[model samples]
Target: MPLSEYEQRVLEQMERQLSSDDPKLVNTFQGRASSGLRRWVLVGLGAVVGLTVLVVGAATSNPIVGVLGFIVMFVSAVLAFSPPRRSGPTGVVGPDGTVRRPGTAPKPSRNQSFVQRMEARWERRRDERGR
Candidate 1:
């Protein structure tokens, strides 16, 4: 099934409005971060250094030295494999302190209850069948 001209026009209008309202927000979604490769390379290097330290320390025979080496290796492996930590203003809490992911409109979401979504889906299905 394809969208009718009217539906396509409506979608285009909506997109235009959204772009106009928050261009920055739209750009963030469109843009891809390119620095992820650098992060991975750094992590790999750290892991190699950590492994070397662990092996040298283990060979020392002293318990403390061995433990330190193990700790370094563990830390390096963890840093290398763990998912990159994301930091940012994900959402600003109101004075009342409710956590909301950024770009989410609370009021619209609140108004769009489960029942409303079901009803909308039902309507769409009915319309498609009628078409």
Candidate 2:
């Protein structure tokens, strides 16, 4: 559905706030380069070829060709679903509670309950929505 002007303005304001608040997030999202129609067409063609090769190899009782066809299918599928590489600092939460993403303020390491964290996030979202 088309958003009304007020809704659009709110969304724009939110976007600006997000961009200013977390440049890493903005960079991650903006740096993504989606595969175009040509890429999809190529992936489709590859899948078709893979299927044909699989069928042919199976019919001819050739295991190598069948394996190759399976590999091709797997590769095409991976390519289709994989997002573009992120350009900003990526963080992984280690088992020892190590969070390391550069270019951002460090969050205090407090062992809050999952429900508490969820509620906090929910409240923040609700406040933003109300704005």
Candidate 3:
């Protein structure tokens, strides 16, 4: 079902808040580089080549060639599973225990329960929308 206008506005507002709060998160998920697909394809090719090399080495009874093939396969598997490095100011936990992101003011520290924290966040959102 299509969202109503109010729901759309709220969704947009939340997105805006997220982007403003942590642009790195938005960038990481956006797939701007288009390298993820290419990386996976290359990894698959490398694995196939490595397997072929391994088979050839085993048939020829060459330990060195087999080792090289194993190394290649290992590296390819590592790269395929490794998480992409994010280059930006990482989040730091303040002395008061609130996470502070780059370029953002530290949130007021409240010794509140999880439910209270969520309620407070919801109240703040409501206040923001009221404006």
Candidate 4:
């Protein structure tokens, strides 16, 4: 269902407030960069493994193994060079804590229990003291 105009306005206001209140949180809504970097690193590792296998097969004079090694290395190199999928901007947390795109409503803060509220308040107090 589409949001009513009032609902959209309220949501926009909340988003503005949230963003202004916690600038660091905006990026977190999408996610950290480590996950993407890890994937590329894995591809590089596979290439290294394939290269090692090729070297070993050549040294052992195993024609079949050498051919397999060559194929693997070629595939690994291609994968390592492939461009990563472009992820959306970070800090757009979805209902499940995963980041969503900007302009999407975050899951309602209604899920915050008393303890969570208390912790938030306490953190705010601590921050005020630091300031």
Which model scores highest in lDDT?
3
Clashing pairs in 4: 27-90, 27-91, 28-91, 29-91, 29-92, 29-93, 30-90, 30-91, 30-92, 92-100
- On TM-score, the candidate that comes out on top is 3
Candidates sorted by lDDT, best first: 3, 2, 4, 1
**lDDT against the true structure, each candidate:** 0.73, 0.78, 0.82, 0.77
lDDT of model 1, residue 113:
85
lDDT of model 1 at position 53 = 73
Q: Candidate order by TM-score, highest to lowest?
A: 3, 1, 4, 2
Candidate 1, residues 6-113, lDDT tens digits: the string is 999999999999999999887776653655787777767776776777677767766776677677667767877778766567786744567788866344346688
lDDT tens readout by residue for model 2, 57-100: 89999999999998888888887897645565588664467886
Q: How does each model score on TM-score? A: 0.47, 0.41, 0.49, 0.43
- Residue pairs in clash, model 2: none
Instruction: Give Cα distance to truth, residue 46, candidate 1, Å.
Output: 1.9
Model 1 TM: 0.47
* Residue-pair clash count for candidate 1: 0
Candidate 3 C-alpha lDDT tens digits along 33-108: 7677788999999998888888889999998899888888988999899997766558887556778786575664
